[model samples]
Target chain A: MKKSWSHESKEYKIYVVLCLILGLAIAAAGLYALQKLLVPKYMRGVVEGSMIAEYYESEVPHEVLFLGDCEVYENISTVALYRDYGISSYIRGSAQQLTWQSYYLLEDTLRYETPEVVVFNVLALKYGEPQSESYNRMTLDGMRWSRSKWDAINASMTEGEHMADYLFPLLRYHSRWDELRSTDFEYAFSRDRVTVNGYYMRCDISPEGEFPAPMPLADYTLPETSMDYLTRMVELCRENDIELILIKAPTLYPYWYEEWDAQVRAFAQEYNVPYINYINLRDNIGLDMSVDTYDAGLHLNLTGAEKFADYIGQYLVNHYELTDFRDVADVARAWEDDILFYDELRDAQNAELAEYGELRSWGANAIEN
Target chain B: MNKKILSVMMASVMALSIAACASEDEDTAPVVLSGGQTAESAEGSGAQEAGETAAASADAYVFTYNGIEIRMNAPANGIIEALGDGYTYFEAPSCAYEGMDKVYTYNSIVVRSYTMDGEDYIAAVELKDDTVATAEGIRIGSTEDEVRAAYGEDGQPGTAGIEYTLGDSFISFIFENGKVVAITYTAIVG
Candidate 1:
């Protein structure tokens, strides 16, 4: 009778252990599924928001890293760098990404692999403090969990954002359930690449138009906080033995003021960094504002981006001792797949333009009802 | 034995609670579209269908001089065609203004258009040279005193320009070299 009672107790203990493990497994899986569903799948529309996150999925190492807001991502063609110069690069960018955000992104990139040169667009330096929460989310939401990401969140959070909300995005995106579409479920596990090595392409051409004169600012000096980040970015690159290049993308408007340009030039000179204001070099680079720009003179379409990339690629080859991977069989084989993807995206965008008289499958309008 | 059953029941309840909250919160939150329309109301009346129909017939829509009769959100192409084909169309970058899409240039006159819910609307018209004048005879070269005499003494003066408010529209005259370099008429939309 005593032996039988002991056996029964042991059986009960084993049953409880099995049940606990099963419950915990189910809970963890459910949480992960919920998190995936709540996050924005940039596959369909507003794909610029997805550019930063897409960098992590790349298995190939980059020789160059371009970091900035829309100006860098929309204006540089990484594929062109690889195709024309055999220089692999990635642009870690998002919409209205601030200067501090760029610093943390560099820190994040160093963790994976250090690039020889880091090109930063200086336009974001105009903003000293955090901008809108939506823009912040577009830049930050795609980052994988790391101390760099945590610091980015802390530095970039606006008035109403909470760090806890970023840690568990379910709290911030709980309301997105009402806006869920079929794409949300389809891309819950994985997403189609939205950019070609961090280069967003637009094939359509819109001639540059008259822009409003920039309103006079009370203070023309660059914001101290933004300048501080610029300093930190320079320091971080120096520590990593990486060369940092400061550039102002030749975007015609949001008017890069002369005062602003002078400040950036002085900063670059002080840091002994290579600073190139593409706005001044547009004529030399052979960029035609009439055809090269997609939206008025604000951003370069694919043609202009390619031209800019070609010009910069030559500079990289001439100045830096980057390897020409064209002769290397393995590198060429890897790039072959990327080139195919780039051509496919270009053809798709052109087809969309022909069918709709405008691009409907890309940009912010790509999200379906 | 009871403890085991209780633990299983508690875990199940927690999971159910989270799922329930997701759906319930979604139901209570409002869905707003890009064009500032409620999703439910926009779908019911079909904003796109109505916009297409309106765009097709925008030739009949006209803004009388000194009046706000311009259709607030009709396609710019149809309206430009209605006015005349001599106008040059310039596609403005989407980032040019908060919501501007394109601009049509006619002689010295420029018309700025906005897009909402994939449909275009006339937002503002400006005269940058001596080729056009307002209904009140205020031309681009009109002086500040002349503007006040033509429109009214009830005007606001700022550092860069001066503005005179009409019913649902306002006229702004930009000052450069101490003279009016441009005059713009803008429609107010909610």
Candidate 2:
């Protein structure tokens, strides 16, 4: 009886071993499944193109995609893109994006949908020293762009400066970032009323209401790396049969130089694409530099965007006029509404900011005509 | 008596071993016989069938939301058609789990390709009540009558019967003992 009992105990030991093995196997499998389903998941502020790729290729197919830094993002309005130029576009641009960053964004856009025209911002080199971090502005893996995702682990040069941009956007953009706190993309698409001189959209003024002066320009050369990316931007557009339009966005007067304008001309000739310098279009574009500039002259005030938009809108309408959305019923309503928004903004900025850029304070004062 | 004793002892050992193993590899999805909706308020035959399918569908999930099993991403496409409303779509990238190097937080959606077994599904989950504030999105807290009213009469029974072509609004209902407890709305932005 003792020997038989011993044999049974041995059987029990084997069963327990087997059960543990089985449990471990199932745990591993569960882990595998979970990882498979979750790892590729992304948080917000990711490259917008990755999510909207098929959508672009499918809907409102366009020939031009404007790529640039924050200036490119906030300055050019997509609503204006369609209404003014009849070109459907996505703001593949981000706030404070550098040329390198623009390169990746353009790469992502072109990867899925090949546009007929590729517009890029070239003022990056003329600003400060070449900033590679500016070019790396694609959304990182976390809620907002995180510093951990940047290659700044072991003290790289020019690491923390631009890296602080995505992390503490408020640091780089100051009051403007506050204006954009949760600025949804729906602003333009939702047909929200835009006041040209609305306090929210206006540049900040000093307590004395003095408009700040614009930053100075440099004959500074693009870093070799930055220039390489710039060249690649043109080459890629050429290879993909995309027409590259090099644009020098308008700056407040005295901040620009003639030598810089010549540099742009040389590059445009080499690339063989039409380069429209707002500087060149300065007087001819028929815009008032004083009233049009928001913060004295760094960027275009709503007044400026209106006239400048008019210039580009008419230029494109005449040159690459697709369909006069003004006539299409459903879309016409949207276009007319956008035009109406432009008017509201135009009126908003034209008003005196007695409330200190509190132009929107006169909300009911600037009601639709 | 000896044979009976041996059988009892063997059975006890086997049961303990199995239980021990299971506890170590435990998954958290409550196993209330997913084949039938959690015996919630099943007031009618239609409710009963819906309850059954809901249970079965939920039981298959090894994940939980707010400590309850994750049903189909609520407010799925079918309910949107019934509501006769439209929604905007937003897609985000997938996140993998960090420490173990496994992705535990992916929402169950086939976004990019067949290889995407699990990608974060950002669509709002619809609740039966459509009013539970669970912080995930808009939760549903209405009853069956309220759900039918919010969704309209066109909401056909079962997942296949529901038409989501109109847009992506998920209509999720909670039923206990076959009677509807709550209805929620999970807005599925593309």
Candidate 2 lDDT, A193-229, residue by residue in tens:
2221111233323111222222111112334656666
Query: Which ranges of candidate 2 are over 4 A from the true structure?
Result: A1-59, A127-219, A253-257, A321-369, B1-190
Tens digits of per-residue lDDT, candidate 1, A293-339, equal 87778889999999999999989999998877776788778778888
Residue A278, candidate 2: Cα error in Å is 1.2
Top candidate on DockQ is: 1
Candidate 1 — which residues are off by over 4 angstroms?
Answer: A1-14, B2-9, B12-190
- lDDT top scorer: 1
Lowest summed lDDT window (length 10), candidate 1 chain B: B29-38
True contacts kept of each: 0.02, 0.00
Give residue B64's lDDT in candidate 2 (0 to 100): 35
